[model samples]
Target: MRTLEETLAWVAEGTALCRRAMAGLDETSLLPGWTRGHVVAHLAGNAEALGNLVRWARTGERTPMYGSPAERDTAIEAGARLPADRLATWFDESARALADAMAHLTADQWRSEVTTAQGRTVPAVEIPWLRAREVLVHAVDLGTGVRFADLPEPFLAELRADILARRGPANVPGVHGDPAEVTAYLAGRPHTGVTTTDGAVAEPLPPWL
Candidate 1:
């Protein structure tokens, strides 16, 4: 795992970038299949959900990130219809609330194991990266034209491997491309302009996440 300081910076940067992506744009398909409002709502909800993991770490209780997938989706939909300013407030405040919850964890508490929504057992130390992943990846998913090339290379590498694992992909094969584009392709995003090792432009890849 990365140091707490580094993970905290990742969380902060992701939130900041998401905020920047939402600026001055109407909620018109910002996430392609979803609106800007929907994406913001989901981000806010994600912070609150991830905070549950922090709570579990601090208290040694089995509080879940969400009760059920349906409820989670419903909550996102409810928040998605909020007026623009209110949605923005929810975004900012939810992130802060998660931070507050995390700040209460002691060193020992930080090592507590938790069951993620995926039913994987992981140390509480992973929460920051989990939240950061959602924030940063979905920020780019907002269709704001934020290029994957702008992400930190280390973070991009992690995301690439993650998507590939979930997607059941093989090796890089005959593909060659800018690191960012390859990472985005791995994330199941629009990865235009990436080329194969044979110098041919690669085709659109499947959704991995």
Candidate 2:
């Protein structure tokens, strides 16, 4: 399992990469697409949501940070309009708050369970790790050219395990073959020995979001 400090560092670095990537983009680059400004909003919203999870873990209450999807969407949309510097500031602050919260957790606290947005129960220990994945993966989704290979090896290993264990949506894309191919596929790049007969073709790494 990843320590809270490790997770926080991942979020910080990923957010920085996002800031750099967005610095190079104009309004056109921020428009809607597979990888777009909306994705950035989603990431920020996710951070807030996870922060709530940390609160619930600490307090044992069923408090919600976002009352509804519409509210979440509105926050993200508003964040999308922020200038790059302001957006980066927002990202940094939110992530730092989350990291600070997680850093205070005890071992028993980390094992506590809470209800996720999907209405499923998950351990608090897993929340920060999941959020770290969200931060990095969605940064890629926002057209940051960073690939899985660019991520820390331990993070990549953890992500590979987590994705394989989950049964929900394939958020990373392109996983129709061997493990190495799956890794390449999820990284948003095609593997040399892989072929897609159906489903979405694995777009190149750091896709033109």
RMSD of every prediction = 2.1, 4.9
Worst 10 residues of 1 by lDDT: 23-32
For each candidate in turn, the TM-score is 0.90, 0.74
Show model 1 residue runs off by greater than 4 Å.
Answer: 24-26, 171-174, 198-201
The alpha-carbon deviation from the true structure for residue 189 of candidate 1, after best TM-score superposition, in angstroms, is: 0.7
Top lDDT prediction, candidate number: 1
Candidate 1 per-residue lDDT over residues 77-196, each given as its tens digit: 888888889999999999999988887788998899998888988999989989878888877877786778877777888777677676665644456778898887666677776787
Clashes of 2: 0
Model 2's TM-score against the true structure: 0.74
Model 1 C-alpha lDDT versus the unseen true structure: 0.81
| Residues 119-153, model 2: lDDT tens digits | 77888887877677776666554554655556677
lDDT of each: 0.81, 0.66
